[model samples]
Target: MEQESFRERRQAQAMGIDLPLGNSPADIRRRMEAIEFLLERSIQIPGTKYAIGLDAVIGLLPVVGDLIAAAMGSFIIWEAKRLGLPRWKLWRMVGNIALDTTLGAVPLAGDAFDLLFRSNSRNLRIVKRHLDKHHPETQIIEG
Candidate 1:
């Protein structure tokens, strides 16, 4: 059963379909956290305390790169909307994506900005805050 489920998820992803993380708030939170981690903090800078993920690395491809990153970032907002986040909060998340994409398009300077401004991480914070306050049971004790 588990293997079948995994295969289905892989197939869906291959075909550009997005499966729901799960039906529960906890499941959604976990999925969003994983996405955020992948997009913003999956890689370390070898010798420095700084870290970056696919967002920064892929943002080096000029226009196409920024668009791809923006699409990935938008997934977080979509999840937040699914969770019924307030309209204003959802708008704020959209603004983050816009700013990140706009400034991240600026050649050398935009690439530098991607390293410092992690929009996905910011959106994850908003999602987490909502989960922690409203669905306290979804909270994970990070050590």
Candidate 2:
């Protein structure tokens, strides 16, 4: 399946090596596009124009909100680690989330920072590109 293979390509890219992966730049593009929808509001989800976004949905939890958000954001670092990203860079990535989580505790101000920072989505993209480069064998499989 393409979904499983996506990780493969991502892994390949992170290593700075070439693999037998085929092309489906669309998948990559789609992911980036999805981040927009995921990280922010885009015309709203129809019935919920004023619906809570990652920033708002996440903000409502107060202290718990930032903790959960930061934890979820840590997935990027986890993914990077899976792709064997350099330790220094990986640490820096974690630091980004830490910073975001810390600063995102200012109530309304923190939510604003979440929207502006969007570090989780940004880091995911960065790691994906890095992984894709080394392991281009992201052949979409169908069953």
Candidate 3:
């Protein structure tokens, strides 16, 4: 019976409809890590100790850059919500995205802020903490 249930859950997830309580911790952790990688440290700065990703590059556009970045950041929050995070944490994530978007709207400063702030990475950390506290069994240890 348990095996059948697990199979059903997996099928649901495969169809892109993640069950609220059916996702394994490992799956969640993996998804969050992927998001962090895409949003934060996908590329290394030459001759510098900094890394960035699409978030920074997209934020380089004049007017629409910040908006695109914020939209991408929203995906992290959406995943957190799907994980059943509390309202407070969800709002905090939104606030982080909002701040990132607002400050990132500046001409040159916003682009720099996108590199420094890394709102998607910040949101990923929040999701990790919530998972660690609430679903420790799903935590994946990285070497």
Best by TM-score: 1
Show where candidate 2 strays beyond 4 Å: 1-56, 139-143
Better of 1 and 2 by TM-score: 1
Regions more than 4 Å wrong, model 3:
1-22
**Clashing residue pairs, backbone N/CA/C < 3 A, model 3:** none
**Predicted candidate 1 versus true structure: per-residue lDDT over 53-83, tens digit per residue:** 9899999999789999999989899989999
lDDT (Cα, tens digit) per residue for candidate 3, span 1-143: 98887897798567544443335766766766666677788788999988888889888897698898788779888878888999999999999999999998999988888888978888888998999899888876779
Q: How many backbone clashes does candidate 3 have?
A: 0
- State, as a TM-score between 0 and 1, how close model 1 is to the true structure: 0.87
Q: TM-scores of all models?
A: 0.87, 0.59, 0.80
By TM-score, the candidates rank as 1, 3, 2
The lDDT for every candidate, in the order shown, is 0.89, 0.62, 0.81
Best by lDDT: 1
Give the worst 10-residue stretch by lDDT in candidate 3: 15-24
Residue 118 lDDT (model 1): 95
